[model samples]
Target: MPATAPSASSAALPTLLRLRDETFDPANPGAYNLYLLASPGRLCLAVADVERRKFVALEEYQLTTGGVPALAEQHDFLSLRGWNAVRLAVTGRAFTLLPSPLFRAGDELAALRLHHTPTPTETVRHTTHPGLELVNVFAADAALADWLTATYGATGRMLHHTSALLAGIVNQRGAASPRRLYLNPGPQELTLVVLGQHLEYCNVFACTTAEDVVYYTILVMQELGLDPEQDEVTVWGELMPDSAVFSLLRTYIRNVRFGFRPGNVQYSYRLNDVFEYRYFDLLSLHFA
Candidate 1:
């Protein structure tokens, strides 16, 4: 999980979750913006009414066979191309962030290589985070990127998955709270972000055990000179309060807590049943 990908491009794929507000206008595609988030694990889409500043629809799906082609086949609004704006984010890819002042236009590949080696089929892209003063450079599926551009015929907002996560976290943290830690955990990995005077650290770690989670958490705290006993850690995921991850975090860190959905926009009552911590990355695309 980007678990932003938490299966198939197939029409037969199960719709894991679908929440729509009565205000959502499937008949008027041009009035709403569409957000598509993809990872090897899953594909999720969200719709927001531009003028109203509210999320009207949220859907999650499994990705498997292919990409993009399914859009033309969807019986729903996803098949439409008249959206006011479309933002696509690819998760579970190789990405690295560099401060804008230190980043030069032509060095996206170099900056990414320092952290990850992209496969031959991947392509390099970069998006600026002016609010955070950082440049997110990442590798996305080459064919998927190409299909999206050719189909849309416009260069819109395309970014790393972490950009959306960072925007949501930064928006949730305020001026008075100078230090914070946020965690987004999936079945096999964790995306951790730490904020000091500014963004102090943000990275995803591959983990297969409860020990891995605690180890990385402590490692980050240790590196940033943060106190596990004092600083607060908020988590956004489907974990139960007594789940192994939470239990270990509370035991070791002493100040861990579950996070809530981003407060930057409004959500439909239909989404109220969906846990606030779930679909966070998909919902945070509103900030993107």
Candidate 2:
């Protein structure tokens, strides 16, 4: 129940979701590995037993407001709650990828332009995963980057939300249906990833209603030559089973199912009480 900054900002937004283990001891920070995820509408942190690969604690706060302006403030407030050594991942939509061979460290913003037109003041950065054979190029506001570094001591592994989503999907690919569509929906944005032999397609769409969700999803299905009546579509992020988005998706796609936790990792029973699909990006940070 304790928080880092119980300011008017925290009071205004309120904590929308929270889950943690009774075994967690804030005093022994070094006993677990910490992961932090900051998004436009949510801020989250989790602790896991590195060796056992089990999540020990998890927390999420929903911002009444959205976008980069509120991230630093919410993050500073979350920091006061409790955390040890940490890994920070920013989950905004402004990110693109370049093959590792073509990536130039100082020109992340330029590389991002291959796909996006970043704002003038956005802080551009890149992280390479040699195994994935691609460098994730992303942008965040300068102030948010500075605050994260000052508080977490310079993040060595900066992940875009897509990186975690891909990692999670790849880890579960073996058990997944032969063809699948994975959707991670945020406040007013949805990230769609189509997986098969390789990543067939991946893109983010700005959406506001259940109708918009169905339109984009079906559009991608058509572009990929997928049959909505047969192909399975697994969803995660902001929507729930009974939510409008999920219901609408089910109406169009016959095999609509919620995603499961990363198949390759172990998790504590505490995490089982919540829907595994909810924090696929945050928990998958272990694999990223």
Q: Residue 156 of candidate 2: its Cα lDDT? A: 31
Model 1's alpha-carbon lDDT is 0.79
TM per candidate: 0.90, 0.84
Candidate 1 lDDT, 28-95, residue by residue in tens: 88888888888766778888888887888888776556655464355355566777888888877488
What are the per-residue Cα lDDT tens digits for candidate 2 across 147-217? Answer: 66665564334668788788878877775458678898876888899877667687888999999999999
Residue 88 displacement in candidate 2 (angstroms): 2.2
In model 1, where do residues sit more than 4 Å from their true spots? 1-12
Give Cα distance to truth, residue 97, candidate 2, Å.
Answer: 1.7
Reference-based lDDT, each prediction: 0.79, 0.74
Local lDDT at 118 for model 2:
78
What's the lDDT for candidate 2?
0.74
